[model samples]
Target: MQQLLAVAIRDILPNKVRLAITRLCFFFNAICSKVLDPVKFDDLENEAVIILCQLEMYFPPAFFDIMVHLIVHLVREIKCCGPVYLRWMYPVERYMKILKGYTKNLHRPEASIVERYIAEEAVEFCSEYIKKAKPVGLPESRHDDRVGGKGSRGLHVITPSVEDLLQAHLYVLNNSNEVLPYIVQHQHLVKQSNPKMSKNWVLKNHNKTFSDWFKDKIFADENVSETLRKLAHGPKRNVITWQGYDINKYSFYTKPMLTVNSKHIR
Candidate 1:
């Protein structure tokens, strides 16, 4: 609608309903920002008042309730207090949502909420001293902060096959910094030896023999990280697999879990 009305509506004050909403949205975003300018507090409040006025033009009188009127005061609060994030309703609303979910006794909602809140707080406090216990909600893996992350939940240990172990070992070696120069040296020599070999063949050949070559070549030197030395030594057959993983704010699931979720959706 904004695109359609773009040519017809020239004034900054939105004539179209959708344009008014867009204007309000932009204004709302500016006020909600973490680092708001105190100098622009008046302008921000004025802008909000204008947006609310514009909204009144588009919406009904009933829509201009107390909640809608509250938008006009947000900038003043920010000016007196600090950033909106520090004083936002989001945390309280989310906590209230959790409390609402605790309503087993619908008639005695206050009682239920108080009881659950106390129990939850008690559990949270006790959890700190309860070593090796899974948390009541959102269980954290001790390995979550480990190098390269250790998945959020449902980690299973298994013994992998020799081929799998070899592939895993070579993969680690290929990506190692200390061993990279050796790999380049090996690749150069391989290329010199087999001039007719394709780039793919060179890579394949390098991968096939680089592990054993590096193990021998690197043992003479003892300056690399213990991790690099271990990678050179090769992985054992045993492995730990994750059903779900959280790495760098991204969540990954195993194929079976994905399949099950898809089936359930279908």
Candidate 2:
């Protein structure tokens, strides 16, 4: 709840108030996350006290209940025992609720629970030998394929416009680390030729002409890396577009999918 609220709150709240909320959420989230280290928990425990003080300044006195105080002790309790989910009462409460449902007769509730439980146990035991039986599990989601950035999908080839192709090819070169030296060298040449040019003017000149300049440079030099040589030649005008591309464990959709409500992307 705090995590979700923090994002929306940042847009609306004053700077100090937003910082308070963001820090509070981080402290709570860090405490509950799976791995526990005493050293980190100790730091979080200290931060918890500061967060409560921040909350106290913003919230009314009535808000400081025993429940709120328990936030500080959470880290200590986890250190003494294990993770909260392993020891919480929620699981026990759920089982008790299930047992209550087996009581069809109010007058003989205990007998009903015992009889139902034994029958359930017997059925489970017998079902183990049934070869055709399938274990019930979570159903497959339709968006499963759209979940990663492994590669491009739904490839459609098109001859892109010259201006768009040049811009895209320039963007690729600008971002690629291997091409950084060539970029710096080209920028130096642009600056040297136009000695009085402003930095922005030099950048504009570089972006406009660097593709051809780099291609010529690559052709003249024989010692350059193959990667740089391929980049110098530039991407084909006939490029492949994707409806979906999976990268960094996320599926991204092209703009056309957004307009038509893509089934693979939510």
Q: How well does candidate 2 score on lDDT at residue 185?
A: 96
Tell me the TM-score of model 2: 0.46
| Candidate 2 deviant stretches above 4 angstroms | 1-156, 242-266
- Candidate 1, after superposition: displacement of residue 198 in Å? 7.1
Most lDDT-accurate candidate: 2
What does each candidate score in C-alpha RMSD?
A: 9.4, 9.2
Question: Which window of 10 residues has the lowest lDDT sum in candidate 2?
Answer: 141-150
| lDDT agreement of model 2 with the native | 0.83
If scored against the real structure, what TM-score would every candidate get? 0.50, 0.46
Q: Give the Cα lDDT of each candidate.
A: 0.76, 0.83
lDDT of 2 by residue, 57-170 (tens): 887899889999998898888888887666779789999999999999899999999999999999988877773555579465345546434446677888979998899999
